[model samples]
Target: MRGPASLQGRLSLWLTLGAVLLWAVAAAWTAVHLRHEMDEVFDSALEEAGQRLLPLAVRDIIGREEDDSPDQGVATLREHDEYFTYVVRDAEGQVLLRSHRADLGVFPPFSGIGFADTATHRVYSDAALRGTITISVAEPLAHRWDVAREALIGLALPLTLIVPASLFGVWAAVRAAMAPIRRFRAGIEARGGGDLSPIPAEGLPSEFQPNARAVNLLLDRLRRALEAERSFTANSAHELRTPVAGALAQVQRLIVEAPDEDTRSRARQVEAALQRLARLSEKLMQLARAEGGRLQAETPVDIAPILRILVADMGRDAGGRLEVSLPDAAVIAPIDPDAFAILARNLIENAMRHGAQDATVRVSLSPDGVLRVVNAGPVVPPEQLARVSRPFERGATDAQGSGLGLAIVEAIATGTDGRLELTSPATGRADGFEAKFATNRIETK
Candidate 1:
C-alpha cells in the first residue's frame, strides 16, 4: 500500500491499530467469562440431579430391612435417561445401586464430605446422605468452546462498527490539528523578497505563537538593515556625484574656452573643489571602515605625540590660534593609532573652523588620562551640544564644512569605551566648547 501522505491518515492508522489491540484483549476476557458462566449453569443442573437420587436411595435402604418388596421404587428410577452417571457404594466398598443398571462398576472415586461435587468451572457442595456422597460433574470441552465462540461474537460485533468510526474521528482530528501549520506555510510562500512585513499571529496554536513572533522580529531587523543600506548608497552617490560633476565641468570649461587669466583661475578654483571632494570621499571611507568594526590592530597611543603632530599639521591652516599645555609626563592609552588620529584631527579641525582667528585653541593631556580640548568661541547651547555628534549635523558657524567630523570623533571615543563631553565654559575665560576624554585611561610611558 502507498503510505499516508497527510498527518490525518497516519493518525488514523495508528489509532485503528491501537483500537484493534484493545478489542482483541476485551474479546479474550469476555470469552473466558462466558465459559465460566455456562459451566456454572451446567454444574448446578448436575447438583440438582444428585440431590433427587439421594432421598429415594435412603428410603429404599430403610425398606430393605423390612423383608424386601424387591425395591421396585429404585428400579423405576433407574429407567430414566443417562444424562448423568450415579452410584451408591456400601461402607464395605461393595456397589449397592447404580443408575447404569448393568455393572459398569461404581462411578469413579470422588472426594466428599456430605454432598461434595466437582465441576469443570469449580466445585459445589450440599447435604446428600448421613455419611457422605460425592458428585463429579463436567461438561464436554466442546461445550466450553461453543460458549467462548458465542461470547466472542457478542463482544466483537459492536466493535466492528465502532472501530471504523473511531479511525475516521482520529483522522479528522489530525487534519484539524495540522491546519494552522499549512496555512502558515502558504502565507510565507506567497510573499516576495521585497515584502518584509510582520506575519499575523491570530488563529494559530499556542506552540506556533512564538514562531509568529520570531518571524515578525526577523522582519523588523531585515527592514532596518534594508533602510540603512539604502541610506548609505544614496549618501555615497550624492557625495561622489558632487565632486565628479564639478571636476567634469571644470575640464569642459578649460577645453572649450581659452580666455584670460581669470578664466584659468576659475579652472584652478574648480580644481580645488575637486581636491576637497577627494579629501571628503577619503574621510568618509575611513569613517565607514572604522565604524564597520574592521580595525583590530590596537596598540598604545600617546596623546602627547598625537596633539603635537596635529598642531604642526594644522598650524598653517590654524593661522596662529593654537596653544598647547604639555604635561611633564607622556600620556598613552590603548587604541588603534589611525582611529585615534582621525578622532584628534576631527576635534582640532572643528575648533579651527568655528573659533575666531584671535580665539585660542588649547590641547592638554591630564595625568589621569583625560585629553581636554578647549577652544575660544561662542559656546554651544546645552540642547544643541548633542546635535553636534550626530552624523551630518553641523553648528551654525560650521556651514562651509561637511558635518561628519564630530560624529567620527564620537565613534572613535565610543569604540574605546571612552566618553566625549561637551560643555559651554564661562565666556572670556573659557568661551568655547570643551571636549574631554577620560583621564583614567591615560598611561604614563
Candidate 2:
C-alpha cells in the first residue's frame, strides 16, 4: 500500500528551499556590493598616491638630476610591501622616476592624467606636479580579486552553518504543531465499535476546532439515525409476533379440520408461508438486538456446553446429516450468553437450510475460541461472498432463507470484539461453504 502523505515533510522541503534561495540571493548581493566598495577604496588610495608623488618627482629631478637617476628615484619610492607600483615622467616624455615593482617598458608613455589598463595591471595617472610632471600608480588586477574572494568567504561560511540549524528547527516546529492532529486521530481510533458519540472538542487547537465540531455533528446525526432504526425494528417485530403466531395456529387448525385433500394441501402451503414470515420477523428482532449497542458481559462463559446444546437441537431436524466436533476441554470466552446463542444458531441454521440434502453439516469449536461450521454445497462466487453477510443478501436465489442469518451473526461478532470470516469451498472440502468466528479473548481448561 502507498504510504500516507506527510504534511510536515512537504512543508519542511519548501521552507528549506526558500531559505536556501534567500540566502543565495543575499550572498550574491553582498559579494557584489563588497567588491564595488573595495574597488572604490583602493582606487581612491591610488589617486592620492599619484598626486603626492607628482610634486616629489619634480623636486627630486630639478635638485638631484646629477646624482639621482630615474632608477634611483624609483628605489626611493618603495616604503612598504603594498600592491601599488608607480612611474613618474616629465613633459618631454622622459622617465624621471620609477618604483621597483613597476614594469618599466610596460608603462605606456603618458598622454594626459587618467586611468588605463595594461596586460597585467590597472594604472591611474596624475599630472598635478608643476602642471607638467605625470605620476602613474599601477597595481596587479589579481590582488583586488584575491581581497574580494577572502571577504566573501568570511561572510558566507557562517551563514552556511546556520542554514542546517535553521532547517532542524523548522522540522521540530512542524512536528510540534502537528501534535494536536495526532491526538485527534488517536481519540477517534480509541472508540468502540458502536460508539457514535460526539467527539470531544476541548484542548484542540483553534484551527482544528471547526473540523472537530463538524465531525461531532456528523456523529450525532448517525447516532440518532441508528437509534431510530433499532427502535423501529424492535417495536415492529414485537407488534407482529402475536398476530403471526395466531395466524400460523389458525392455518394449522384449518389443515387439521379440512375434509378434502385439496383443502388440506392448500392449508399446508399457507402454513408454510406463515412460517417463513414468522421466521423473518424473528430474525429481524434478533438482528436489532445484536446491533443494539448493548454492553456484553465481561465474565467468562464456556462455549462447549452451548455448542452441545445447539447441536442436539439442530440434529433433531437434521436427522443423520449433522456432525459436531468439540474439544474435550472447555473453551471459555468473555461474551453475552444470549448473543452467543443467537450467533451460533443462525450460522448452523444457515448451513443446514442451504446445504445439499444428502450433504452432512459439520460444526467444530476449537480451544482458541474459533467456532467453524461447514456444509457441502456449490461453491459461492467470491464476488457474492462479501455481500452475503449483509442484510437480505443470500448466496443462491432459490434457497429458502430470510437472508438475515449471516448479517445477524456478523453484528454479534462485531459487538463482542470478534471476527467472522466466510469462505467458499470450505477447508478440505471441494464444494462447500464455511463460516468461522474468532473471539478476541479465549481460555481453555
Candidate 3:
C-alpha cells in the first residue's frame, strides 16, 4: 500500500507503528514469562501432594483387615470436580488404592521418584515404608494451558485501545511542528507586485530556516537591482534634457539666420530632431517615475483642475480640434498631481497625433474619476490593440512621437491600484481608438 503523502501523516504513521511493534514485543515476552512461572508453581503443588499422601497411604494399607484387588477405587464423601488425583501402589507395582476420579491408565508404572510427565497429566511420585508403598499425584496439563491463555488475552486487549490514541497523539504533534512551515508558505504567497519584504523565520525549525533565508536573500537582491535600474534611467533622462533643449534653441536660431532657403530647411530638420530627442528623454523620466511606485498622494486632490489646465494648454495648438466634457463637481482622487498630469498629457497627445486630419478629439472625465480619450482613426487590429499599450509598441499609425505614452499611463495607473482599459473602435464609434484610465483610487467630494 502507498503511504501517506503529507509530512504530518507520514510521521504519525511511522511513530504509531513503532509504538505498536514495541507493545507486541512486550506482550509476547510477558506471555512467555507467565508460562514459565505457572509451570514452576503447578510443579511445586504436585510434589507437595505426593510427599504428604505417601505416609498416609502406607498406614491405610497396613490397617486393612483383608487383601484388596489389583486396583481398588477409593470412595469419596461428596461429588465435585477433581483437578488433582492420586493412586497408591505396592512393591509388586499393583495399584492397591485409587481416588474416585483417578484413572489407572493416566498414571505410568512406578518411576523411581520426583516429578514426571505423562501424555495428558503432570505426575509426581514419592515412596514410603522403605519402598513398600508409593503414591503418584497427577494434574491435567489442559488446566495450565487455559490459565496462560487467559492471562495473554488480558495483556493484548488494552493495546487495541491504545493504538488509536497513540496514532492521534502522533498526528497532533506532527501538525503542531509543521505550523511554522505553513506560515512561511502563506507569507510567500501574499507577496506580489512591488512587495519585496523579507519573510520572518523566527520559531521555524533549523532545517527549514535555510530555505526562508535563501528567499529573503533573493528578494533583497531583486530590490537593489530594481532601485539601481530606475535610478539610472531617471538620471540619464534628466541629464540629457538640458543639453537637448539648448541644442534645439541653437538650431532654431540657425534656421532664422540662414541666408539660403536650403540652409534654413536643413536647420529646421535639425531642430525637429532635437525636439524629438527632448520628448523621448521626457518620456523616459516619466517611465522611471511610474516604475518607482511613487504615484500615491498623502491627501485627496482635485484632478479635474489638472485635467482642465492640461486640455487648455494642449488645445491652444489643436486649432479647434479638441472637445472636452467634465462633471460639474470636482473629481477628487488619491494620486500625485504630477503623475496625473503626465497620465492626462499622454492620452491627449496620443489622440491628437493619431486622429484623422481636422477630426475632433474628445476628452471626458466622469464624476468617479474615469478619464476617457477617444480619437478618430482606423480601427486597430485585434492582435495589435493589446500590444500598443506596451513600451515602443506603436500600432500602424503614422504619427511622429515616442511610443511610451500609453505604457507610462498603464504603469502610473497600476502603481496607484487603478486600472486601464483600451478599446479599438471607441464605444459607439465605427473607426476610432480609446484609452480609458479608471482611477478607482478616488474619493469624490
Which ranges in model 2 have alpha carbons more than 4 Å from their true place?
1-10, 44-69, 72-120, 124-135, 149-168, 185-193, 205-207, 253-264, 295-317, 320-337, 365-370, 413-419, 439-445
User: Which regions of candidate 3 are displaced past 4 Å?
Assistant: 1-195, 203-205
The TM-score that candidate 2 achieves is 0.77
Question: Over all chains combined, what TM-score does candidate 1 have?
Answer: 0.44
| Selected candidate, larger TM-score, 1 vs 3 | 3
The window of 10 residues in a row where model 1 has the poorest summed lDDT is 117-126
Ranking by TM-score: 2, 3, 1
Q: Worst lDDT window (10 residues) for model 2? A: 69-78
lDDT of each: 0.66, 0.85, 0.89
Name the lDDT value of residue 96 in candidate 3: 81
Candidate whose lDDT is highest: 3
Once fitted onto the true fold, the runs of candidate 1 whose alpha carbons sit more than 4 angstroms away are 1-258, 294-297, 426-430
Q: Name the candidate, 2 or 3, with the larger lDDT value.
A: 3
**Candidate 2 residue-wise lDDT, 1-445, digit = tens:** 4422797777766787788889889999989998999989988888888878777777777788576555554454446766888887777777777877677766777867778888888789888555577788898888988999999899888777877887788788988988878777777776554778766666778988989988878778888888899989988988889999999999999999999999999999999998898998999999999988663666888878988998898789888888999999988888888888899999999998898878898999988889999999899999999899999998765879999999999999998889999999899878999999988878788
What residue pairs are clashing in model 2? 74-98
**Predicted candidate 3 versus true structure: per-residue lDDT over 1-445, tens digit per residue:** 9999988899999999999999999999989998999899999988888887777778878878675565778788999878889999988888888889998899998868888898799999889878878898999999888888899999998988999999999899989999998888888986544466798888899999889999999988887898899899999999999999899989999998999999999999999899889999999999999888768888889999999999999989999989999888998999999999999999999999987867999999999999999999899998998798899999997789799999999889887888999998999999999989987767787
lDDT of 1: 0.66
